[model samples]
Target: MSRVVWGACLLVASTAFVACADSGQTAAVARLASGEVAVSGTPEGIPAHAPARFEFGTEASATRVAMWDIDVRPDGEGLPPGSGSVAQGREVYNVYCVACHGPTGMEGPNDRLVDSEQWDDVPSTRTVGNYWPHATTLYDYIRKAMPQLTPGILSDDQVYAVIAYILWMNEIVPEDTVLDAETLPAVVMPARDKFVVDDRVGGTGPVR
Candidate 1:
């Protein structure tokens, strides 16, 4: 049985190698736009290369590195210190967001940030309130890539405020709610229980 499995593995490996080589080869009748015959496959054998151990680029400063390391996790980890209220968010929305996202977050030329009362409407939209599992995701995404044209310009307070407004519009949070790193993660989204973690490895085994 072991020998059988080993033979099968070798056969599979050889077949895969052949497939890769075949894929690299161009069709026999293929021609370039300039009316020249195209090279079929890459030249055989690996070419001379640079030293693998050679290092490039200066060591980056911690402060400069921190700017790019702004991804907030699902658990609200990496949230910067800041707070914003629903009222403040509404004002921010009107000023900076209304152009692309429309009056409310729902009337959008872009993706709607507000939740729909009914999901069965003729023009259905997937919103952050009803679809997103984590509130931190909102804070993270908005802070990283909002305002459309000029991304990463909003302060932490503004990001929090806009998140608050969107959450309020969805009815996920009360209009008077204040959002910060501490409270943002605590506001469990409606779809939180719907998502399941997939840990599968091999098809016939238990979740890894």
Candidate 2:
């Protein structure tokens, strides 16, 4: 008696089983011995038992892709069109940010956003103002993830406003300054010079 074994094969679009008969019972014996059996009805290289096409999900729409494509770079490349003042930022911060960051941004239940000491002072607590290397990153971070409870809930205007308020509290910007794509990136951070470039290439040792 000849034994028949069904071997599983995976096509680019579908999965199917290839029939293999041992004991020289059929033409598939030679191909099956080489682990490459040809199915009767399938196309040249495809298995006959496989479906013509199979896909897991629908294609993503342009609008859906755009929604997740929001990312701001250090040079302010991707900043959206919006403007926000310190006063407006204060309002937005009080409503949405004060609970986690506290009224002045110093007394925070979360990470502190303001620090009175200069970067050279080597402050024990690493606040945003004393440790952050770029001002543009503040806008990126707040816009993408903020408010503790709900992330990405703030509009562009609101995000700019909140950043302005935080910058003012840190003494990095004037209390009356308004933040926008044009002005926000140009605001130099206090700790900008503190960070060193990582020029080291691949190695097994420490980064230094």
Cα RMSD for candidates in order: 15.5, 19.0
Task: Please estimate how well model 1 matches the true structure, expressed as its whole-model Cα lDDT.
Answer: 0.75
- Per-prediction TM-score, please? 0.65, 0.66
Total residue pair clashes for candidate 1: 0
Question: TM-score winner among the candidates?
Answer: 2
**Poorest stretch of ten by lDDT in candidate 1:** 25-34
Candidate 2 lDDT over 1-208, as tens digits, reads 0122122212311211122222123443334445575564656775767677667689888788767868776667668999999999999999999999899998878888899578465767778778888888988889888876999889999999989988998888999899999999899888876664333556786765
* CA-lDDT, candidates in order: 0.75, 0.76
As a whole number from 0 to 100, the lDDT of residue 163 in candidate 1 is 89
